[model samples]
Each structure stands twice: as C-alpha cells, then as structure tokens.
Target: MKKVLSMMMVLLLFVGMLAGCTSNTAPTETKEPEALKMGLVVSTLNNPFFVTLKDGAEAKAKEIGAELIVLDSQNDPAKELANVEDLVTKKVAAILINPTDSDAVGSAIKLANEAKIPVITLDRGANAGEVVTHIASDNVAGGKMAGKFIVDKLGGSGKAVELEGIAGTSAARDRGQGFNEAVNGTGIEVVAKQTADFDRTKGLSVMENILQAQPEINAVFAHNDEMALGALKAIEASGREIMVVGFDATDDAVKAVEEGKLAATVAQQPDKIGSLGVEMADKVLKGESVDSFVPVDLKLVTK
Candidate 1:
C-alpha cells in the first residue's frame, strides 16, 4: 500500500509540473506593419501627357512597395491647393506635384513645407517654397531646337505663327523664351502669337482664329504637342502646307510625325521624369541628399 501511495504521489507531481509549464507559456506577440505612403498631384488628367506621368509614378511606387495616392487638380490652382491639403491631412510620407500654374502652386508647397513633408516637382515647378528636387527636361533648350528646325526648314525666312501654352506656367514662359531667342535673328517673322491655354480644343479654336487672320503662314510653333496637333488639324482643313513644330513627343505626336503630319517634336520623357521624382522622394525620405534639379534628356523626333 505504501509503494502504491508513493507511485500516485509521483504521478501527481508530474501532473502539477505539466500544469505549471502550460500556465507559464506566453502568447505570441503580433507586430504592426510599417507605414509607407506617397502622394501624387497632377495638374490635369485630361491631357495624355500628364496621364503618362502618373503611370510612371504609379509603376515606381508599386515596385518600391509603397502606397500611392493620386489626385487630379483639373488645371485649377484652388483645386491643387486643396489636394495638397488633403494629402497633408492624410500624413503622407512624401508628395510629388505637377503644378498647373508654377507661381500659383507656391501656397500649396508652403503648406507641405509647414507640415514637414518633402515635395518634389515633376514636369512643372513652383516659383516659391522649398522643393526637394525638380525633375524635368530642359524646356528652353528644346524650344530652341524646335526654333532652329523651323528656321532651317523654312530657309531662315518665312512667316510663322506661335501657339502659346497656359500663360502663367513656367513651361510656356521658358519654351517661348527659348523659341524667341532662336528665331530672333533668323528672319523667321512671327506674325501672330496667341495663348491656347494648353488644351487641344482651345488649340484648335485658337489656331482657327489665327488662320483667319494670317492665311499665309509658312510655319507654326506650338508650345506642346496638343497645340501642335490642333494647329495641324486647322492647317489640314485649310489645305495649307505649314511646317509645324511641337514639344512633348506624346504617342499621338510620334504617330503624327511618322505619318508626316507633324514636322518635329522635342521629346521629353514624362515617364522618366515621374519615375525619377519618386526615386528622389524615396531617397530624401531615407535621409539621402538629392540634387535641386534633376534634368532628363530630350530628343527631337521628326518624320
């Protein structure tokens, strides 16, 4: 009986040990996910050029495993400012902006600055506020190239019309400056110059009006492909053989060039600009120093 009691006591001790082991075991702890967020504010989605820019930024964001929030400003300065505010409210890690109006975007950039969020300008730039970097092609040089092409094609003496972009934007200003600088001493007279606001429809209407006023234009220089294509349509309808030069070698513009509709275009890689902007933003967030201006290369595409 004593031996039986000893065995039972040993079994009870074993059971107690098992219970203590079970009770002392700790539950596995779960970790929270790391935060990664990016914001993209486009000036306008109506234009195919800006759409391509957005696509590049999206592709880069996906590759880097970050969440990208895209907002279309619809070419409105107020809307752009509002969108920047919304992104700030969302506490995004960084922001990439293609401003509708370079000067008007200052207020929005200031807000981002106050919130301590880094801002990178793509394609377009802000006149005021701190930007981590500005990624774009040299528009002035591109415009000069286009001007030189026009001068060469027309043998340095011809009547030309200029289709300008949005008045307040840096692109329109810089491109016009370059074109003017090149054409000044070339004897290529600019008989008419007008703003089209960078819209295809506007470009069409504006070019139509310009055509009515100046019927004997030898060449046309449009600030962007949209305007160039519009001017082309007007020229086609009028049965005129005006040499047209455009910027932004968009896909449609490229096709137009291949078909001999557009004379030439200064091809700025919107995709590269977008991707580089995101890459720079990432580096800035990682405490890396980046250049104030990152210039993408440009090529003149012609038929």
Candidate 2:
C-alpha cells in the first residue's frame, strides 16, 4: 500500500510539471512587426542624377527599417509599365515612380490605383492618374535660371541651341517653356532646338550634325548634363568656343563647371527629392495625408 501511494504521488507531480511546461512560454519568443514593403521605379539607372536619387531612397529605407524594392525602366515607357505591373503583383504598400514620360506613365499609375496602393511621384509626375504627392524641384524655375544666365552673359544677344529631353516628359516641357519665356523679350535667339532624348551619345551625334550645318553658334543649353557634356565634346573636337549650360548639376557637370569647361548648370536636389518621396510614402502608410505637390529647391552652379 505504501509503494502504491508513492507511485501515485509521483504521477501527479509529473502531470503538474507537464502542465506548467506547456502553459509557460519564453519571454524571448515575442513576435516582431512586419516591415513595410515599398517599391521605387526609376526611369533609368543610366543617369548619375537618378543613381544618386536611388541611393538616397535606399538610405532612408534602411534608416526607417522599411523594405524598398527598386526597379529600372531603362527609359522605356513599356518597361516602366512592366515594372509597375510587377510591383502591383507584389502588392507593395506604396510605389514611388520617376516616370519615363508624363503621359505614358498614366496607365502604369492607374494599375497601382486599381490595386489600392498609394502612388507618389519622385522626380517626374504623371498626367493620367491619381497620386498622393509629387516630390521634385521646380524644373521651370531652373530652366529660367539657365536661360537668364545666358542672356545676361551675352548682353542680351547670342545664338544658342536648345537640347531637349524626352518629348513627353514634364521636365522637358516645363524647362523648354521657362527657357523660351526667359529669352522671349531678350536679344538671345535660340538658333537650333533639337531633341537628344537626354542621352549623351545622341547629344554628341546631334551636336556634330548641327556643327556641320550651322557655322556660327554662340551658346548651347541642354536639358540635362549628359547631353551638355556630349555637346561640349563635339565643340571641343571642332575647337569652337561656345558657352554650354546644363541642367541637373550632376557630379560630372559640377566638375565641368569648376574646371571652367561648362559655363553653368542648374542644380536640383535629386537626393532630397528621393528621400522626400519615401518619407511621404511612409506618412501615407501611417494614415497621414501629404501635399499634392512637394517641391524641392533648385540653384545654379557656375565657375
């Protein structure tokens, strides 16, 4: 009888121990909150300005512990569409886009809107769809600065060439408009206005052609630095002394300015634009509202 009682007590103790072990959980087993997933669609990683923009966005994402998925459109509208659709499939919390073309990006923005994902514009804006905010510099103002510099330098009389960006891009349109407005009343005559598609190679070829056709060109204003540098090379090859003004004060462009090779370049804060876009997306994800248009500052860099 003593032995049986001892066995029963041991069984009861074992049962209690089992219950305690099953009910108690380790304090270290606490769950972590999921990271917010965001998407960034760049028009092209080819340009240094856009590359810096991407780096800024990535830095912000790392600082805030958010997941950022970056995609390159390669400056193709079709590729941009494909990129947006892929992001939508992933069901990201928000999408920030630097559109290849303002008009072409409308359909891509519509996809995100249909999926109930928040959309924000980084450097460029979309004309077709709804967006929570547009973060960029005042492109028109920058263009005006470039134009006025040329006018003032030439004492209101000079022959210049305008190298345009992608035709349908907002940056191109606004920059062209502002430049034209600035030169309207002045004696600065834009002898040649051509599209180089914002590419250095195209700029080189176009400028080479123009140099052959036009004998007397005083200045050249390119929408972006890549084209400006390209035109500069062509002019150098032909040994012509012409003032070249570029936009997007990229590192190379700034260097050119410092070396007295480039007259001046309108500087836009691309990194700030990128960082601001991510910050705005974060706000929207947290149920906060943002402005319809968020404009970054711009300045002119010259030697």
Candidate 3:
C-alpha cells in the first residue's frame, strides 16, 4: 500500500509538470521573440513621393512594434549597395528597397540573397537577383491613363512630349512603355522625349529646351508630379496653352489640378505601398510566405 501510494503521487506530479501548472510555478507562455528588426533602403528622400513612402513605412513599423532601420541611397547605386551591406551587417530579418536603377540594384539584391535575407522591392524592380516580392502601384496602367487622357482630350490627334523618370528604373521603363503604346496607332505623335531624372528643376530646364526645339507642342506627360509642375511652369512662362498630365498626384499636383492649372495627374497610394511593405516584412519574419508581386491601386485625378 505504501509503494502503491508513492507511485500514484509521483505520476500525479509528473502530469502537473507536463501541464505547466505546478503550485510553485504558474503556467508560463512562450513569448514572441522581441527582435523583429527590419530595414528599409530608399533611393532618395529628396522627392516628396519617396519621403511619403518612408513616412508610411515608419508609421507601420511603429504600430507593429518592429524596429525599422532606414537608409537613403541618395539616388546613387554605389550608395545603395553600401546601404544594403550595412543592413546585412545589422542582421535584419528582412529588407525593403526602392532601387535607384533597376539594373544597378541587382548587385545589392544579390548581397541580401547571399545573407539569406528576404527582400521586397518598392516602387521599382531589380533586373537581376532573387526578390521575395515587389510592391508598387500599377505604374504601367498609370502611364496609360495619363496617355489616354491626353489622347482623348486632344480628340485623338496632337503633338506631345514625354518627360521620363530615371532612365534605368523599372518605373521609368514601364511608364514609358505604356505611354508609347497608348500613342502608337493614334494621331498623337510624340515628337520628342527627354529624361529629367525625375527632378523638378531638371524638368523645368528640359521642358524649356523642348519647348524651343519642338515648335508644335499641344500636350505633355511627365512621369511624376514634380516634373509635371516644373513643366507647367515652363509652359506658363512660354505662354503656350499646352495641356499637361502628370503621375503621382501629390499634394501640389492635386492642388494644381484643382486650380485648373494642370490638366490631370495619375494618383497612386504611396502610403499604402509603404505600409503594405512593412506588413509583408513582418509576415516574412513570422515565417509567413508572401506573394511575388503586390500592387497598390491608382486613379486619374483631374478637375
């Protein structure tokens, strides 16, 4: 009877231990790892669009209690590579990058891949390397929207000039492709196209030059709002009644449209892109698989 009682008590203690309900110790739950670190590499913050993007990512990170390390490439590919290296050294769980140049960013993406870190490309894509996902608005559709706006407004016949974004970026390539396609069989002739490097100052100067070179300019399409506003200034100075269409309906661009100064602008949700990127990165850290491409919505904003 003594042996039997001793064995039963021992078995009860073992069961209590397994249940994690011993009298001396309450039930202990497994805590989530506190180090959910993420890294964001932005091409440049000089542009309002990218600045807004950074803000969105930061906000989301704060909401989710994740640590976000932001590095700006200043539109330099070498700097972009260095930034990725820095992130890798920090051993971040995931990386988000807005590439300055699609082809030039391949090396940086490869570095992250070697480190076994997942990468999410924002706004632009890499020409090479493995990326877990790419997030952005439908740039091609936005470009087509801008082009179609001009085509229909001009009654399908007009002369226009395109002010492109950074030459080697996916945004530039896709937008230009869609725009060109929209104008291809129509009477809308793209007499001259120029690169403004997506800079407002450069856009103003380039448009000034194009205005002089192209005698008949009925419309203009800039890849972004900064360039569009710049081109609008040039057109206003030249006193030419040219209809201007722009992408990235930023505050200034939307205001211009409302004031009847700018014809139209393609609106993209930059905030959504940034927030979604961070959410996806969090999911990746949590061992969740994300899709290869996540597209934000777009709209044509006009008066």
Residue runs of model 2 more than 4 Å from their true location after superposition: 1-22, 25-28
Q: Which residue segments of model 1 deviate by more than 4 Å? A: 1-27
lDDT of 2 by residue, 217-301 (tens): 9999999999999999999999999999999999999999999999999999888888998999999999998899999999999
- Clashing pairs for model 2 are none
lDDT of each: 0.93, 0.94, 0.94
lDDT of each residue in 105-185, candidate 1, tens digit only: 999999999999999999888899999999998999998999999998989999999999998898999899999999998
lDDT string for model 3 (1-303, tens) is 999999999999999787775555775689888857999999999999999999999999999998999999999999999999999999999999999999999999999999999999999999999998999988888889999999999999989999999999999999998899898899999998999999999999999999999989999999999999999999999998999999988999999999999999999988888999999988887889899999999999999
RMSD of 2: 2.0
- Pairs of residues at least 3 apart in sequence or in different chains that clash in candidate 3: none
Question: Which residue pairs show backbone clashes in model 1?
Answer: none
How many times do residue backbones clash in model 1?
0
Name the TM-score of candidate 1. 0.94
TM-score of each: 0.94, 0.94, 0.89
Q: After superposition, how far is residue 262 of candidate 3 from its true place, in Å?
A: 0.9
